[model samples]
Target: MTGTRTVVRHAPGKLFVAGEYAVVEPGTPAIVTAVGRTVTVTVRAADEPGVVIASDLVAQAMRWRWRGDRLEVCPGQDGPRVRRAAAHVVSAVETVARLLAEHGLPAPQLHVSVSSDLHEAGTKFGLGSSGAVTVAAVAAVAAHHGLELSLESRFRLALLATARIDPNGSGGDLAASTWGGWVAYRAPDRAFVLDLALRRGVGEALRAPWPGLAVRPLPPPRGLRLEVGWTGRPASTTSLVAGLHRRTWRGSASHQDFIKTSTDFVNAATDALETGDDGALLHQIRRAREELARLDAEERLGIFTPELTALCAAAEAVGGAAKPSGAGGGDCGIALLDAAAGHDIAHVRQRWAATGVQPLSVGPTPERNQE
Candidate 1:
């Protein structure tokens, strides 16, 4: 938006390096990394009252009004009051407005414009686009209101907005988007967090000690080349997680085993990253692939598809380690290889092309580690 007063912010998308389904539970450790792809949010003061959020991905800009401490759709809009298209944007505005309200400030008029490069020809690469968008929106909106939030505060507000939309998220992607490099993340108890926010206020909730939330930076690989492959189809993390939730496996011993095994290796992988143990990291990647395969077998979650299988097989054939990146029914996968082995990398790409997998030229976002 071109306006006298405006703020723009960018947040990078993320891919899960290791740790998946089990990370949904509070405090479960996971490794995630920020990618070069990003979503940009531009916030400008509106000419009149109310708010309008327009996304390049969506057809229409949604209008909303502040009803006390919340945002409600203006009467007679194209879609319903709460739309799936701009759900993250809506939640972000409401959450930040609540925070402003707690500080005795009136919610200002806004026009939030969003643009994202996380997709190819309108198809998502499954690189946590929602998380990136939320993070960017929260930061831009807060800044436009003259609120200079610390990294921790901005992350907290983003997570709160995310939880308000869907409490089942692990928030690891948010950590990657906020921090801009490899990170080891643990989720907070969302139910407790939402309740605290509702009862007390955003200011108090921001100050409260979240029981299981943690985020730490991990060292980058010294000699491994990270390659991403897209399956040309998008996968829904929500549906995959919901399928797991529907099964009566939460307290099952096998489920407990899955959690335990995933946690152990993710912790080990963190250590390997710290020590620059490329071989050990490769071992953990293989281990993670096996664990996800086992979980799929036990739960019938369809976590793996033929394309993903080929993607992994091709990586292994090229003397590399690979696995499905996230929920991975048909989204994206990651592989690590010797940085100098260009021939092997080309062969791997050729195999992926033969199997209908598209290798994406994505790398870690060029930025320093978060302090």
Candidate 2:
């Protein structure tokens, strides 16, 4: 790595298009995008091979090193399943180390710090906080070690690192946080990269241009609004993803049919955005959510808590259609509310407070949601 000090700030969490569960189905193309909350990673060289921590993730300082295919984790204690935690840390380090080597840079003696605005314990939002942190960490480490990687290459390495740990992992969250905003990633074989350009509007309005301008010929939509809520329950995304693959491989014909229909619905939803037809888009959104429910039922996914269900109903009753965000047992939900409903979005959020899940008021950022 080249620089002495490097800081990488990455936005947290993501929303999916189709294939929330199917992403683990190996070839399924999952659509994901970055949101407002973010985690920042700052890296500096240390004299030793130990890792110092200052994040809500773990209490004690963590240390580890690359040991071939295995990461040798030294957790400083046998305190209650420290082994497992160390394993995760080691896996992350190994993958990141390989990524740096792939770019022809040596790993530096690193001091890393991470901070996020998302819920601490519920970092279980199943939006891949671990992977996001790993991405930021890798970026910081690479910069410190003097390696320069293309943005696409960085995302690719992060995904590879994450997969080395959780093979059933969806590359969505890594892509979302690294690239930011809506991305329609086709299956890996097709190598299709569709830029929604959702960030341009916000960028122009703020008089700041987004980074990573590749000059893709895509036009931004006119106006848009999104209402996001929490389900108040966290999901074991790895398990859920594994289950999805198992079920899909079992050749449940009905599930196969459902996937096709859902893909079509999602495609229609995307088409609605291009037409500047919020009315049609809202309808498509509702249809997509309904299709997601059917798929979730088949996969036995989205087991919402009572509070989450109540919140969903409440949002629907208030001129919106609500759906769980990630692979859901509940981390959060998104409600694409119609602007004509005359319902104050703020007031709607207030109602959700009784359920312990606060509504997040989000707007496009200058970074990615460009026109």
Candidate 3:
């Protein structure tokens, strides 16, 4: 029999829309979208012993034996999270093994490698890295084990794995990582991946292409330009998110009100996006910052760190609005400026640098998916 290998790579980080910290609460809802970084999994046949797995970011290597009833993982020197993540992989394999055994089939001895382009893998940016990685890794495991699972099924399975690791996570991260592009979201609920038709024409738009498709035939627009800055202070997202959830569970009415306000801010931002109106987009971003400040006042919102607060104020001084984009409490802040007017992009860059913050440009658009 000829052995063929499959490699799956999923791109982009994501943002939480409605739920935020509340999604971790019992029955709270949230929405997220894959932005533009990636995790990739490659699978091929191995003549070696058992099943082998490796990851660059986690710096882990593991071996597992796949017996009919269970999958056992022999941990390498990776950290606690990596070791814990390994168990999730084994669980997925066991699930696959169970399915295959029912079909009177044998699971393959496979070798897999997982890698990611995470700027701050250890920090909590609230970009849903763990969820995305879980989804991508499990998809690889499913492929190597010869399991028949649909994309939706695979996404849900990944969410289950991530939830085991981080109970407060809404699973929106996994869904967004599985499906890219602009999204309309509600927490704990599924997000809608938008397929926008451009005013100029459908052929010329430049959003992330849907999976299993090719780039469009037409040329994309001039591109999306923004200044991305890092706050340089690392925060533990696990603890922060858990604490936020606990606050919500205690019926901290103030906290809930702040979340509601943030939701309104995002809803306004969504309208701006649909209209493709730059002025309105900036207006909504400003509104989001104001609402986030109210949330920050609660001390549980986790929006402001000294560096992040400085960065936000600085960006606004330059005619842009800035706020915590990801899980907050300090990872990074995004500054949306008027690219057309050349609105003090350099000033914002200098201000960020003064605080030892790094300026990463979210420059230009890439090609979109086509028929």
Candidate 4:
């Protein structure tokens, strides 16, 4: 564990292109892309016996000790409120320990520092900052411990660690962070995976093939331009998803219809992307916005706020297709514009700013390095 070289890893934040709530259900697909904003983790040998973590996003330094198989946070931290933010890191450490043990290597004493470009002024832009951090940390720590993991292994580890942190997550963000670029993702069966993890442990769960889990890479649309605008307010994805679940929308005729339409849109969009069909892509985007609006109206879940609606309208006025990205009540809205209408992005940005939105400079990032 001594004299280990520092390992640095970067993982990009994610944005949803299409399909949201439906993706939580098994076999339902959602399109997500890893953006330029990233979380970086640096892992180096520690002088102390235990691990110390410094995070710029949380603005806190925390210590954790590995006692046998368990990772325990050191008592008496400055910010109690920020403790929850460490859950993902703790899970990563635990998982990495297991991975090292599985490879017959002892866990190392390390110091880890996490920094991010995904947030502005203490406010998250709903760009999957936590997922990126978790992915980067897991990758860096595992490499530091002399375990080289495949992309699939890294993804499974990240997903398992993230699921431990927030059980309600669908793991789309984790997939984006691991795979990068544009991907069509379907959530793994959480209930089944959690049960297996509880009984056989996370390592066993990672070794097993995840039934119904799908992650497919998609070609980026040619001549397609993306613009992201933040609402200057954060939205709780957990709360929004919980509200949808409380309604028991699953298996209902209306819910089924919505899913079918969304699936069709995704398929059409996929085809449009492959063919560089800007018109079809725009149509699909608008269709998705309409369907999401219908669901919001019927459920009264407030998925679309006034700001989101105004942002979409402004984007549409310039002949681009726009919608609220992710589980939106606020956060950011994304617009897809064609090359011919790219000049209108400035106008759209101005309109969004006038409505209290801040334009973000981000686009799809490359995949994680195989080495």
On TM-score, the candidate that comes out on top is: 1
- With a 3 Å backbone cut-off (N, CA, C), the pairs that clash in candidate 3 are 12-36, 12-37, 29-187, 29-188, 30-186, 30-187, 30-188, 126-327, 209-369, 214-370
Q: Model 2: C-alpha RMSD to truth?
A: 7.9
Q: Which stretches of candidate 3 lie over 4 Å from their true place?
A: 1-6, 15-19, 22-33, 58-60, 66-72, 75-108, 120-127, 145-151, 189-224, 248-250, 300-302, 361-371
lDDT of 2 by residue, 107-204 (tens): 54566667666555635454556666766766666566665665655565555556556756656677676766566543331111111112232112
Worst 10 residues of 1 by lDDT: 362-371
How would you encode candidate 1's per-residue C-alpha lDDT over 1-371 as one tens digit per residue? 12247888999999999999889999999999999999999999887688898887767788888887677888877665336768898899889989887777787689999898998556789989899999999988888877878777888999999998888988888999998889999999999999999999888888999989998888789999999999988899989997888889987999899999999999999999999999999999999999999988888888889999999999999779999999889999999999999999999999999999999987997543322
Write down the lDDT that model 1 would get.
0.88
Candidate that would win on lDDT:
1
Give the range where candidate 2 is weakest over 10 consecutive residues by summed lDDT. Answer: 189-198
The estimated TM-scores of all candidates read: 0.96, 0.80, 0.75, 0.94
Q: Across residues 1-371, which tens digit of lDDT does each residue of candidate 3 receive?
A: 22256646454566543335544443333334455666666777766757777767565577777665665665544466766656555554554444444456567576767666655565534455566667776666666555555555565556445554555555666666665554544333222111221132212211323222211111111222456677776666677766665654346677667556666665666665666765666776677666667666756556787778888888789677777766677776777776665648787888889987777643322322320
Report clash pairs, candidate 4.
none
Compared with the true structure, the alpha-carbon lDDT of candidate 3 equals: 0.57
Task: Give the Å error, residue 79, model 4.
Answer: 3.9
Candidate models: Cα lDDT each? 0.88, 0.57, 0.57, 0.84
* Candidate 4 ranges with C-alpha deviation above 4 Å: 1-3, 201-203
Candidate 3 lDDT at 45 equals 74
**Which prediction has more favorable TM-score, 1 or 3?**
1
Q: Which 10 consecutive positions of candidate 3 have the poorest summed lDDT?
A: 213-222
Candidate 4 local lDDT, 1-371, one digit each (tens)? 33388999999999989988878777788889999999999999988887888887577788888799777788887666566767777788887877677667676688988888898666789999888888998999988877768887888888778777667788899899998998888888877887787788767887887877998888877887888988887999889987787777867999999889988898888788778888898999898899889999999888898889989999899889999999889988899876566568778889998998888999888766686
